[model samples]
Structures are given as C-alpha cells and as structure tokens.
Target: MVRPDGSIRVGTATVAGVLAGTVLAGCGTVGGSPAGKETSSTREQDTKAVRSAYGKTAEQDTARVTLRVQTSADGTSMTASGRGTVDLRDGDSVMTLSAQGGRVEQRVVDQVLYQKLPRSEVPGGKPWIRIDLQKAAERRAVGGQSVNDPVQAAAFARAIDGKDVTREGTSEVGEVNTTHYRVAVDVAELPDGATLRRQLGPTLPMDVWLDGDGRIRRQQIDMTLKAPAEDAATDRASSPPRPAKVRTVMEFSDFGTDVEAKAPPPRQVTDLTGTALERGQTQN
Candidate 1:
C-alpha cells in the first residue's frame, strides 16, 4: 500500500509511481529531566509513567493493525486500507492492502519484504517481488524504517511531556478504562525518526488513550500537509497543488500474541532480479 508519506516499497526500491502514494519514541527522560523515573501520581508523573510503559514492549510483541489513509494530490483522492497482524518484535507482518483498483498481498519476514503483484511483469507470470531491507537501508530505501529494534517504551516522554498536556477524561476502549490525553505532537521535539511528522508535516494533533498499565490502547493523529511530493497525478501544469489531509487511528489489541510469517509458495513467487529490480522505482 502507499505509505502515508505517499510512497511504497516493494523491497528496498521505492514504488512511488506504483501506489497513488504510499505509506515513536518512549517516555523516560524529559527535557533535561531525570533520566529514568516511572511514576503516575501527578500529571508529570503520569506522563513519565506513560513514557515508561511505552518503553516496555518486549513482553508485548504481536498486534493486529488496521490502517486507513486518504491522500489527495493531482486533482485526485485515493483511499487505502490495510488490515493485518504484525510481530512487533521481529517486524514481520502479513497484510493485504487494497488500492489502485485491486488488492495485493505483502509480507515482511526476516528483513525481506515480498509482494505478490496484481499483474505479473515477470516471465511465466511470476507474481512476487522481493526486496531486502538490510541492503535497502544502506541506500535509504522506502522501507528502511522497518528495522524492528526494541524501542524504549516511555521514550516519547522526552518529546511529549513538556508540551501542554490535557487529560480530557476517562474513556472505555473495549473493556479497558483508559485515561485520554490530547496534545500536539511536535516533530521538532522528537529525537527518533519522525515518520508520522514527516508524513503529516509540521506539527499534528494527537489523541491517546492509556490503560492502567500505562500501555497505549489507542492513538489518533490528524493533520493536513502539502503532499510529500509533486502530486503523482499532476500533469505538467503547476497550479497550486492540493493539500492532503490524513487521519490515522491505531488500536492495539492481543498484545504478546503469537505472530508468524512465511514466504509465498515458490510457485507463486517471482524474484525481481537484475533490471526488473532497477526498473519501476519512482523518485518523488
């Protein structure tokens, strides 16, 4: 699927022209604040607890993800969705993404991402394309961010705690009662890769729900930004391009669940070797 940033990665290569587009830190230390404190009594304490809790993801690895995005550029708007399960610990995920008039299956296993294309350009109608993320990362490929390293749960605390935080109230997400907080996600404040910030551009609004365990139950981000690239659909004309507004909600469930990914059957797979791998990579 097109990443929210309006790019797609088939392996290490960017399929920007392929999809209409494409498609967090923990708490801990905050602004010269003490390095490691996990408390939740006061608002500051609560933020620290959250930042810490977010840091503790090793015990919770697998989760189901439902993602939706609407991108407008080039006088056209594209809506896409991905419903899948991911192994956060290993960064392995299998998903079916719907867009561009059809559906394609994508699986990331062992730092290798494989896609079964909607139309096979390979000989014998091979349906799969492979990209090695390890190799791609050195080149800064589209999916380079797929590194599945364990992140400090509360790492975001350093970025968000100092901002004005408002705990709106308590809400029930599923069976869990959660404390809801609304804050602006400042990209400049973040130390890690600003993936969302880069996608939404500038600062964006964020709403988060944290369970008693200080684990994130849900998060929502909404923002509008000039499209990340020249509108893929735009012709030669250069009238003011359309701005794309995106809203994303992530609800995590079944934490620590079992998640396993495997390659497509060999018969159904196609290795995008040599020139085929060099072709179709669109740079925006």
Candidate 2:
C-alpha cells in the first residue's frame, strides 16, 4: 500500500489536473453587467421570487437536490471533485458527499461522518472506509442551515421587509439564463469568520445569481487574509510551509427524489497502516 502522503500526492495531482482542464474548456468567459448598473426594484423582485420558491414551512415535504462540488486547496495545489445531495424541507436539509480517486474513496453521509483510508488497506481489500457523518455535519452547521452567507440572509430579509430590492442584471451560465441581484449590507455588519475575511479584506463583496424560480444558480465572493511577507527571512522561518493552489469542480444531475438514498451498513475504517498489520498476521 502507498504511504498516506504519497497517496495524497497522487490523488491531488490527478484531481487538480482534471479540474483545470474542465474549467478552461467549459467555463468560458462570463460576460454581464458591471457593478452599479442594476436597479433596486429588479434586485428585490429577484430575491423575493427565489425566497418564495424555496422558502417553505417546516412541515413541507422535502425537495431533493444533487450538486457537484469542485475544491482546490491553496497550499497543496491539488483539486478534487465530489458529489453532494441535499434533501431540503422548510429550513432543514440533509447533505451527503462522495469523493474518490486512485486507490482511495470517501463518503460523507448526511454531512455527518467523514472517513478516508486506502482502498487496499481494508482486511478484505474493500476499497472504501466508513465515517460518522452525523457528528461532522453538526460541527459544521453550528452557524445556520442555508448555503448562502448569513449576512446575505439578513440583508435579504430586511430588504423584503423594507420593500427594497436591487436587480443586478442577467447572465448566461452553461446555457441557462440567470438573473443577478445585489443585496446591500454594511461591511461591519458581516459575521466573523465569514469567507470574505478568509479571501479578501475585511469587507465582503458579493454577487448572487438565481434562476427564474429563485434557485441560486451561482455566487462570487471576495475577501482577504494576512500572512508573513514572502521575503527570504520569512521563508526560512516558516515552519510548516504553505500548500499549493489547486481547484476541483464537480456537477451532479438526475437525483432520484422518489428513490431515497440509503446509507451503507456500519464498517471499520481502513488505511495503509492497517493493511500492513493484517498482512503480517496472515503470513503467520
């Protein structure tokens, strides 16, 4: 079995390369309105329409959604793809994701369990590991349930209450026509630890686009962070070193809403170290 670090190296390269190629080939230049052009009334109508379409009482039946996720870690320069499914009703939802590459596969059931180990590491050579997704989901969902930013949520709600909405414009995303909206919020009002703080400056700049029914089609956000100056002195003193920048992208479709997804039976997690131990005992 490959060493954990070695496996990570191989998997990262494969996933990152695939993501780069796809993004370049499929995501052509996005052309649309620049900032400061959209009218307030237009934005309001778009937000209202989306909220009305998705907002439901807690007792409402759940709607199933399958989304593709592509992630690139900045330090590792590796990209990976995963499939996520959400069953949402009212404000509650269940999310699951599965990602695989090389001799490794990982599954997160209901955003709770997170298990990853080598495929060849299992006792019987099973190529996957089981994790507890329920615990993981709860830890990550402490803030709220919606996928969008909390600030945006509050801004949207206030806009609806104040009868003000800003329509940014229209753009095409993969042949789908999407309407854009710019919901206003003060920079100081943003929640701490928001993605904006991680990506750009303290202020959060965002653009949200929705389909005709108010389903979020896409979102762009900008923020910043501080790091040691990249001078020679800083480099020599850096202990862990920085990771590479790689991005992954994934897409999912045709989720069978009627056919519910069932979790696999309980099993032990597997890894390269475990496989070595099992093989040694077998030799006796």
Candidate 3:
C-alpha cells in the first residue's frame, strides 16, 4: 500500500511517514552564555537569540524529523533509526520504525494511535493495533511513548527553559548553517514523559541548533545509565555500577508544511481498548 507520504507499505503493516530516534516529550529553556568570540550580540543576548529561534520553531504547524539513536550500557548495545512527522497544531503523527526485512508503521489521530508492529510482535496475526493515549498514560507510558504526539512537540523547547545556555558558534544541519547552543537539563526539569531518571538519573546533556528564521534545525541528546550497586546484604558491592551511554540525534525540516499522512485502511486496523487493550498494553 502506498501512504500519503509516498512510501509503500510492506507485509501486513500499512506504510507511512517516518525519527532520531527520540520523540520529544519535554524541552526547556537554556543556560550559560555564548562561546567563541565577542560579536555584535552580547553573550547573554546571543543566548536569548538562540532561544528565540527555537521558540518560533516550536510554534510552527509541522516538523519533519529524521532520527538516529544508539544506546549502550551494562555490556549490551542497541541501535534504532527511523523517520517521522509531527503535526505541531495537534500532536498527531506518523512514523515508520525499523523491523527485520520490512518496516512497521503507525499513525496517531485524536489521541488514538494505530500501529503495525513487526510481524514477530503481531498478536494473533493481526496486522494493525490501535492504542488510546489516554489509556496508555494510565499505564505508566506517559512521557516518551507520546513523543510522536503534538503535545510533546509543543513542550520540547521547554527543555532549555530557565537553564543556562551558550552559543557554540555555527554548525551545518541538513546542509543549513545553524547557530548551535549547548544546554544542560536537570532531571527534575524535564517534561513529564521525558524524564531521565531511568536513563541518566541526575542530568541529561543536550544540544540545540536553529536556522536563520529561528526555527529548530537539529538536536542532540546524551543520556547515560549506570548499573545499580549490588545489594550489600546479598553480597559484596562487586561490579559497582557500570555506565552506559545513549545518543539521540534529531534533524528537522519542512517546518509549517503539511504532512501527507492519513489513517490506515479500516480492515487493516484493530482497536487496543477493552479486552484487546488489556492483552496489548504498551506498558506495564
């Protein structure tokens, strides 16, 4: 099947739209001052200029995001890559995640998400699964699970809110020369669903890039995990805590443009509410 974005669906899953791997949940204000040399804009003023650009980008009608993510810790490593679009006005989105041999895609509308899992993850041979975000939030999947949704898109810039930010000069993103900013995010300040307690614990490192129009151009988020200290009662504090790093990169383009995404065919879609909802809860 050909999706509105002009991508063909493979297998039973309907194909559409497409990520760095991280769906935005919480974004904030910035900290610090401009780096490099003195210029026409004061360091503090440059920081605000950078923040202003992101502020405007967040208010656009849509964002086309390409993403790559790599996570490593505890001697294991995992990598995920995808592409997707977010409707800034409504939090609706479509994404195609990586799967063996083919791609598993999903669409979000009216707080309901319709998705096609990898064939290996399909239940009872069903090609598509529908999930209600309102319900999913009840099950502890609140933060990042809703990244594809617009609510997070609106809130993403909040990551730099009230924090010190510094200009890192200019860098090219998606071939566009962008002004770069370095930001530090306290775990407590992150948006509700984008908290790093489970990933980074204390703080998360982040980067933001903006183009001339003050729109977001790219982002980099660094998260690290540490293995828990062994139980003193059970045995010696051996193994201490092994640290792992996760890198997430997101590039944005096509701001304010309409995304070509539509609902999958009805026959191919299944609801995740009721008993089906219980059987397929996306979280615990």
RMSD of each: 8.0, 9.8, 7.6
Compose the digit string of candidate 2's lDDT tens values, residues 159-244: 24222335555766545566665444334344443542342334333444565545544443222223323533456665633432
**Model 2, runs deviating above 4 Å:** 1-37, 46-76, 89-111, 114-118, 121-168, 172-175, 181-207, 219-256, 268-284
lDDT (0 to 1) per candidate: 0.51, 0.34, 0.54
* lDDT per residue (tens digit) for residues 1-284 in model 1: 44322323211111211221122222221222232342345557655555665555435777665444455655677776555666655567666677666676777777666776666334467777666644544343342132112232333455566344556667776566777776665655553346545655555566667788777666555557554454534733756566665554445567776656798777876554332334324432
Across residues 54-77, which tens digit of lDDT does each residue of candidate 3 receive? 447657877776655566766786
- What TM-score, computed on C-alpha atoms, does each candidate reach? 0.66, 0.49, 0.69
| 47: Cα error in model 1, Å | 1.9
Model 2 vs. true fold: TM: 0.49
